[model samples]
Target: MRNPLDENKLEGHLRSVAAAGCQITLQDLEGYRPQTQPSTTSLEYESQYKLLVQRLVRSFSLEQLTQVLELYHLQPPPKPTKRKCARSIVEQEWNWPSLADVRRKKIDSEFSSQTFPLARHVSFLLLGKDGSQLRQLSLRHNVHVSFSDRPLSLKAEGLSGSLRLLEQDVKDFMAGITQETFALPVKRTISLASIQHISRTSGAFLETVDSQKLRIFYNKSHPHTLVLAKELIMQGLCQVTNLYI
Candidate 1:
């Protein structure tokens, strides 16, 4: 049997029930505005839902829930943040092949040539104080090189050295430093023409290449990379760093 109530009357009945049993207020259904930027309908829906949930408690049924939510218009899920893989970091950190190493080796292979030779790059197999091997550079050119002696250093993964961090870390660490452009073979390693082992009393020294953000950590008489870089900058070397490019 059809009841005599009109559609408006039925809506009013539903609204009254929702008002009593749930938190759908006139404000909830109609929304709000202020002096600032106009709020989106989505926000209004969220606010309404919050009000409804708090008001409804355990009384909200599936059908009632669907009716209220149909107007809300939910947003899509946010995109995921892509993290740099640590292996790539390790490879970049160490696998940086050096052109200078090649130049040095070439000099070693040949005899005296009147031509002034330059050290383009170097890669060292650093042995521990013990006879045991510690690390090996896959390559090192104008850039820094980090290599581990473990057989893993030569993997398709880009030099996977054993008991050592991955190459990606090395790369990322390098990424931290901004490279200065020189006329050289653009983007090539600078070789140390010579190494005179000069040992003396203490002052300061380079702790590590990557931890150079702290300005307070520099001591002049003591030689650290950042300090050396600072001195070089004073002497007209471009100082590029994670903090300053």
Candidate 2:
């Protein structure tokens, strides 16, 4: 090779080498080999990236969206809040995560919390009029989580351990059941797009999905339900309409 390091050519040569390295790296990671020739400018790479994202967004499901956000450190747009306005006057304002991002963090937190080996069960007794007994609901289940691109499959017994109260006195009405066990299999499939709203009761909630209402829960120490809820919300697949915690 000619003396490419000569003063006149060194800078241009180095720039060319750096660009080639970047192109190779991008091509390797993205499986986007240049069609006609190697990319000679950053603009080419940028255009390719934009096109890739456009294609991805069209078919991105809840799980797909979450993966992309985490991979690129991207977040959903921030929701306008009064607290943000109050902090605008300060030089150093509080930097907070978006609602969707909050759920991602919650998944991690829930995972950590479960390792403590604390009590994993809580039983609630519903009372009727005049403080009379209605029914007792027990939250007892082993929690496991499995994630995929489109649907979230919950496999295990006792998935319906959670409860939702849409109308008053509904619990009282169900108190007449003489069933011996409330444990039911958690083998269920969830479609995020079909969910309208999510309501949680600290550890459990009922929500409407595909016009059908269902309940889910995270036992005392297990946070699989919470993690699932947050993931759904963060992905914009479901909205958290009510939370009683």
* Backbone clashes in model 2: 2
Model 1 misplaced stretches (Cα beyond 4 Å): 1-74, 77-167, 178-223, 226-245
For 1-245, candidate 2 gives per-residue lDDT tens digits of 22424522533443443445432122221332113321323335445433433333332333333433344444433562323321221111113223334344444334221111111121111221222222221222233322222332212222222212211223333342221111212323335443334323223333433333344433323355456545554443222322211
Model 2 stretches with alpha carbons more than 4 Å out: 1-43, 67-245
Candidate closest to the true structure, highest TM-score: 1
Provide the TM-score for each candidate, comma-separated: 0.18, 0.15
lDDT of every predicted structure (CA atoms): 0.29, 0.31
Shift in Å, residue 200, candidate 1: 14
Tens digits of per-residue lDDT for model 1 on 68-158? 4344432212331111111111123223223344334444444221211111111111221231222332233112233333422322222
Question: In terms of lDDT, which candidate is strongest?
Answer: 2
Q: Summing lDDT over every window of 10 consecutive residues in candidate 2, give the lowest-scoring window.
A: 113-122
lDDT of 1 at 27: 39
Q: How many clashing residue pairs are found in candidate 1? A: 40
